[model samples]
Target: MANRGRLFWKILLGFWLIFLLTTQLLWAVFTLYNPRHEAPEDNIARRIGNVQIGTAGAVLARGGLQALEELKASWPPDERKFFSDSPVVDAPPQGEGALPSMQQTRGAVSRLVMAPDGQRYLLRYDLDGLRNEYHQGRRSSILHMPPPLFWLGLTGGLLFSLLLAWNLTRPMLQLRRAFERVSRGDLSVRLFPVMRRRHDEITDVAKDFDSMAERLQVLVSDREALLHDVSHELRSPLARLQLAIGLAHQNPKNVYASLDRIEHEAGRLDRMIGELLALSRAEHQGALGEDYFDLLGLVEAVVNDARYEAQVPGVDIQLTAHQPEDYTVKGNAEMMRRGVENIVRNALRFSAHGQSVFVSLSRVDSLLEITVADQGPGVEESKLSSIFDPFVRVNGPLNGKGYGLGLAITRKVVLAHGGQVEAFNGPGGGLAIRLRLPHWE
Candidate 1:
C-alpha cells in the first residue's frame, strides 16, 4: 500500500512537469520568432520633436528674433518650454567649417535657422521630456503572460494529473488487497462485481480473479468431502475386523473361520487403499506418462477382462467398433486402461443374470468416444451427475464388493487426459457411461 502511494505521486508529478515544461518551451519559441519592435513612446517622441523644431525654425527665419520671441511669449507656459530659440551672432565659418546640418543636444533637438535679413537663430525642442511622459502612460507588453494566469494553469494541471493517477492506481490497489486476502485462505473474495462498470483491461483481470477464486473454493470443498468419506469407509471395515478377532478369542474351536474372515477383510482394505492411490494419481495430471495408444485396442482389452467376471452372473458382454480404423489417443496407456476397465467392471456389477453389457468405440467429430452401458437398473435422474463422486453407490446385491471409488477414479483419469466423462440413464432402462478423449491425428 505504501508502494502504491509512491506510484501515485510519481505519476502525478511526472504528468504535471511534462505539461509545464511543454508550455514554457512553446512560450520561449514564440518570443524568439516574433522579436519586439521599437517602443511606441520612443517613436512618438522623435516624430513630435521633428515637427516642433521645424515650426520654430520657420518662425525665426521669416519673423526674425523679435517676432520669434513674441510667438514664444504668446504660447502657454507648458508649450513654450518645448519651442525655445537662441540667436546665432557669430558668422558662419568657411565652406568646409560650416555648421553641421543639425545638432542633437542632451534631451533636446537643436536646429540653426537664418532670417531673410541675414539674422541667425538656433531652434530647440525637448525630446527626452516627451519620451518620459509617453513612457508613464504606456501599458505592459502582450508577448509576456501575467502571473495570475500562470498560477491558474499550474493549478489546473496539478489537479488533472492527480485525477488521472487516482483512476489508474485505485483499481491496482484493490487487486493487491484482494490477492492478499486470497493468500490468507479467504477464497470467497471477488472483484468483478465492484469493477465491472470500468469496461477495460482491469475489469477483465477482475473477472479472471473471480474465476480463480471460485475454482479454488470448489477444489478445497471437494478435498474436504473426499477426506471425510475416506475416513467413514475405513471405519466400517476396521469395526468388522475387530469383531471377528473378538469372536476368535471367545471360541478357539472356530479359529480357522475367524482367520479366513480376517484375511478377507485385510484383502478388502488392501484393494481399497490401492484404488485410493490410483484416484490420487489420476487427480494429479503431471504424474501421468504420455503415450499414444489405440482406443479400440484398450476398449477390447477391458471388455475381454470383464467377460470372466460377467460369467459368474451369467451376463453376456459384447464389444462393437463403428469404424474399421483403430482410433488413436494420446495419454498414459496404463491409466487409460484402468479408467476403461473401471467403467466396464462397474457395468458388469449392475447387470443381472442373463443380461448383456454393451461396450462400443467410435469416432465423433474430432474425439474418440468409448461408451459402456448395462442392461440393469439405471440410476435416478437427479443423482446421475453425482454417480462419479467418491463413496457414492446405488443399492444392489454386489454393491458391497466395491468401495465406490471406481467411477470416481475413471472421472479423474479422463479429466487428466483432457477428456470428459458423463453418466445417463439408457433409453432401454440401464445406466450408460461415456468417455470422450481428443483423437490423435
Candidate 2:
C-alpha cells in the first residue's frame, strides 16, 4: 500500500543515490592512487659518485703509508662517516691480492641503491624529493578524472528521472482521452496501457472501469431501441382496435367477435406495455428478492389460465416434483406467474393437435426450476436469441400471429427476480423453455 507521493520520492531518491554513490567511489579511488610509491628515474648520487668512485678505488689500492697517512693528516675524524675516504672494497694491505676495506653508515642522501649487479648501483633520494614529485601527480589526477564522471552521472540521472516520469504519465493521458471519448457519448472507448511485466492495482481498476462502461453502453443502447419499438408497435394496435370498436354495431354477433378480437389484441398490447415497464423498472430496482411464492402454485395457475384460449392444441400441463409438496421461491409472485404463463401460452399457440404442452416445477438445491415444453416445431438455434427481442416472431411469414413480446417479457421478469431463463431443443424433439429462481429451502 505505498502511496503515490511516497512511490515517486522513492524512485527519485533511488536514482539520486546511485549517482552519488558512484561519484563517491570514483573520488575515493582517484585520491588513493598516489604516484609517489614508484622508484625515481635518476638521482643526484649517481652523477656525484661516478667521478669520485674510480679515484677512490686507486687511492685505497696504495694505502700502505700514503693512504693511511693522508687519511689521518687531511681527513677529519668527525666527518669520516659523511665523506668516504676510499672505495677499495674489502682490500687487505701487503696481501697477495687485496685492497683496504672501509665502510661508513651515512644518511640515504641519494644512497647508492645497487642495481643488483653487485658491481654497479643506482642512487636514490630522500623525503623532500619524494613529497615534491608526488604532490604534482595527486593534484592533476584529482583535478581531471573525478569531476567529469560525477557530472556525467548526475546529468544522466536527471534525464533518466525525466524519462521515467514521462513513461508513467503517458498511460494516465491515454486513460483521460478514453474518458473524454466516453463523455462525448462514444462508449466503446478502450485503453491499451503500456507497462512492464509487473501488475499493479491501477491497471486492474482501469480494466474494471472499462468493463462497467461497456455494460452501460450495451444497456443504454438496448433501452433506447426498446423504447422506440414499443412506441411504434403500441400505436398500431391501439389505433386499429379503437377504429374496430367504433364500428362494432354492423352485425351483432360478428361485431361481438370483432370486439373480442380487439380485446384480445388490446390485452396482448397491455401485456407488452407492462413488460416494457418492468424492464425499465428492473434496470433501476437494484435487488428485491425478498418475496417468496409457491413455484408449483404459480405454474399451475398460469397453465390453467392459458387453457382458456388454447383450442387448436389442447393444453397438457404436467408438474413433476421430486418432493411431493409445493416448491416456493423468493421473487415477485405476480410477475413470475405472468412470465410462466407467457411461455405456456406461446407453446400452446405453436403446438399441433393432440401434442402435449408439458410443464414441471421442482426444487433442487434451494432453486425452484420451472420448465415449460411443447411438442411444437422447435425454433432455429440462430433465431432463439432474436426471438427474445421484442417484435421478433418465431411464426413463419404465412402465419400472421400475435406480437412477439412474450418471451422478452418472460426474460425481463426472470432477470428482475435474480433468476435466469433459457430456451433449447428438448431431448425428444420439442422446444424446451426453462426458468430458474432462487428458492427458500
Candidate 3:
C-alpha cells in the first residue's frame, strides 16, 4: 500500500547501501591483497648503512684520518650532513683485547671495522632518516594511486540510481492518477499509449488497466439501458391492469371480461418477473460443475417443445443433428437447456409462415457448436453486436412475443459455462445465432 514516491526512495536507498557495501568490500580486498603481513627485516636500510660505513672505513684505511677528512670535504653537500660527529682513534685499554665491539651513534651510525693498527675509525649514517623517506614514499603512492577511477564509479552509480528510480516511480505515479480517475467515474481513462514505450511489468499493468476500464464502460452503459427498458416493460403491464380495474369498477355487469383481461395481464407480468429473475441468476451464477450429460438430447428436447409452442403461421422447427450418439458436455444440464431453448424459441418467434427454423449441432475441435438459424428478417447490422445484451430487442415483426431478456439470459448462461454466443445474418436470409461450449473430452 505504500505510495510510489515512498517506494522509490526505499529502492534508491537500498541500491545505495548495496553500492557502499560493494565499495567497502573492494577496498578490503585490495588492502589485504598482500598476503605476507609479517614485517621483513629492513634489508634496504641495512644495505645503505653497510655501504656508507664500508666506504668511509676504506678511505680511512687507505689514507690517514687527515686524508679521510680531505675525502669527506670533497663530498657533496647532501652527503656531508650524515657525518655530524667527530671521529675517535684509540688502542685497546689496559685489560681489554684488540677485537672491536659493535657500537652505533644516533641509532644510525655504526662501527664497521677496526683499523689494522692500534688506531680505530668511526662511521656515521642516519637510519631514522632512511626510514622516514621510505614510509613517506609508501604513503604518497597509496594516496595518489588512480583516485579518479573511484570518483568516476561513484558518480556513475549515483546517476544510474537516480535514472532507475525515476523510471520505476514515474509509471507508478501515472497509474495512481489513472486509478483516481477511474474511481471518479472516468471510465475513459487509459494508460496504454502513454506506457507503450516501456517494456516491463509496469507496461503490463497499464495494459490491464486499459482493458478493465473498457469493460467497465461497456457494463455501465448496458446497465443504464437495462434500467430504462425494465421501467418501460413494467409500466405497460401495470397500466393495462389499472385500466382493467377501473373499467370493472365502472361496470359491475361486465366484470367477467375485465377479470379475464386482468388475469392475462397478471400472467404476462408474472412471466416477465420470472424471466428477469432467470436472467439475473444466469448472470451471477457460480462455477459450473461436472454434471456431464447429452447436449444433443437437450437440444432435441428444446426443439420439440418449441415446435409444439410455435404460433407463427406455417412456421416449422426442425433438428438437423445426425450422429452415431449424442454430444456430451460438462456443465449444469438445466442451464444449457435454457440457453439453447431461448435461442430456438427466439428464432421460432421471428420466422414467417412456411419458414423453417434449423437447429444444428456438431463438434468443432474441443467445442460443441450449436447454431439456430431462422428465415425471419435479420437484425440491423449496427445492432448485431449488442443483440445479446439485457433488454435489447431488435425492431421486427415478432418483437412483442417476449421481453428482451431471453437472449441476454442465454448469453449469460453460455458465458458462465466458459462458452460464447454470436449472432450474425445468415448468408441466404434471416439471422443465425451460434453457441459454442466446451465439450467433455
Candidate 4:
C-alpha cells in the first residue's frame, strides 16, 4: 500500500512539474520575442517623438523661429517640454543637409531646420520624457499576467495529473492484491473479469495471471489425487504380504507356497515403486537433460524388445518406416526409450495369438511421428482420454496384469519434451497410440 501511494505521488508530481515548466518556458519565449524590446529608435514611442520634432521643424522653416516659439508657448506644459530650438550662426548646407533631419543625443533628439531667410535653427525633443509619460498613462506592464487565470490553470493541471495517476495505480494495486491472494493458496481468484473492460496491456497481464492461477490449481488437485491413488495401490500389496505371512504361520505344510507368494508380492511392489519413480522423473522438465539422439533408432530398439515378448503370445511385431529422414530429437535418451517401450509393450499385451502389432515411424513436417497399433479390443470411446492418466485402467482380460502407470509415464515424458500423445481406436479393430516429437535440425 505504501509503495502504491509513492507511485501515485511520483506520477502526480511529474505531470504537474511538466505543466509548470511548459508554462514558464512559454512566458520566457514571449518576453524574448516581444516587439517592445527591439531597438529604441524603431519603437512606437521613438517614432511619435520624431513626428513631434518634424512638426516643430516644419513651423520654423515656413514661419521662422519666432512663430515656432509662439506655438510652443501656447501648448500644455507636458507637450512644451518636448520642443526646444537654438539659432545657428552659419546658414545650413544645400541639398540633404538643408533638409530637416534628426540625430540622437542622451535620451533626446535634435534636428537642423532652415528658415526661408537662410537662418538655421537646431530643434530638440526629450525622447526619455515622452516614453516615461506614455508608460505612466498606460498604468500596466506587458509581462504581468492575471493571477486568476494562472491559479485556474495550475488547479486544472493538478486535477488532471491526479486523475491520470489514480487511473494507472488503481489497476496495479488490484493486481498486487491478487498476487497476495494467490501466494496464500487462493488459486480460485480471477482478475480478467474485473479488468476486461480496460482492454489494455494491464488487461493482458490480468489474463496471464488468471491462467497461471488456474494451472497451479490443476497441478495441486492432480498431486492430491495421485497421492491418494498411490496410497491405495500400496495398501493392497502390503495387505497381501501380511496375509501370506499369516498363512505360512498357520499351515507349516504349505510354507513353501506362502514364501513363493511373498516373493512375488515383493517383486510386484519393487516394480511398482520403480515405475512410480520413473513417472515422477518424467513430469519434471528440468531433470530431462537435453541430449540429441536418433528417434528412429530408439523406436527400433523398443520394437526389437517387444518382439521377444510377443513370441510367447504368438503375436507378430512389425516395424515400418515411411520416407525416413533425419529423425533426430533432443531429450533424455533413457526417458525417451522408456516412453516408447511402454507404448509398444502395452500394444503387445492386448494382442491375441496370430495377431499383429504394427509400429511405424515417419517424419511429418518439423515433427517425428511414431505410431503403435494393436489387433486387439480397443478402449471405450468415453475412457480414451483417461487411459493416459495414472492408475486408470480399462477393464479387460489383462486388467490386473500390471499397475496402470506406463501410459501415464509416457504422457509425462512426451509433454516434458514438448511433444504430444493421443490414444484412439483403429479403423479396423484395436487401439492406436500416436506420439509426435519436435524434430531437431
Q: Give all TM-scores, in the order shown.
A: 0.76, 0.56, 0.75, 0.76
Tens-place lDDT per residue, model 2, 10-106, is 5666776776677767666765785653334323333333333434344433443255347545645543333333223343323333322322222
- Score candidate 1 by lDDT: 0.83
Model 2 residue 275 CA deviation (Å) reads 2.5
lDDT per model vs. reference = 0.83, 0.64, 0.77, 0.86
Ten-residue stretch with the least lDDT total in model 2: 113-122
Error of 2 at 95 (Å): 54
What TM-score does prediction 4 earn?
A: 0.76
Ranking by TM-score: 4, 1, 3, 2
Query: Which residue runs does candidate 1 get wrong by more than 4 Å?
Result: 1-4, 30-149, 249-255, 324-326, 396-399
How well is each residue in 257-375 modelled by candidate 4, as lDDT tens digits?
Answer: 98998998999899999999999999999998979999888888888888888889899999999743898999999999999999998988888999999999998899999999998
TM-score pick, better of 1 and 2: 1
Runs of candidate 3 with Cα error greater than 4 angstroms are 1-5, 34-156, 245-259, 285-287, 310-315, 352-354, 377-383, 395-399
The sequence of per-residue lDDT tens digits that candidate 1 reaches over residues 219-286 is 99999999999999998888989989999999997689889988999999999999999999999988
Report the Cα lDDT for candidate 2.
0.64
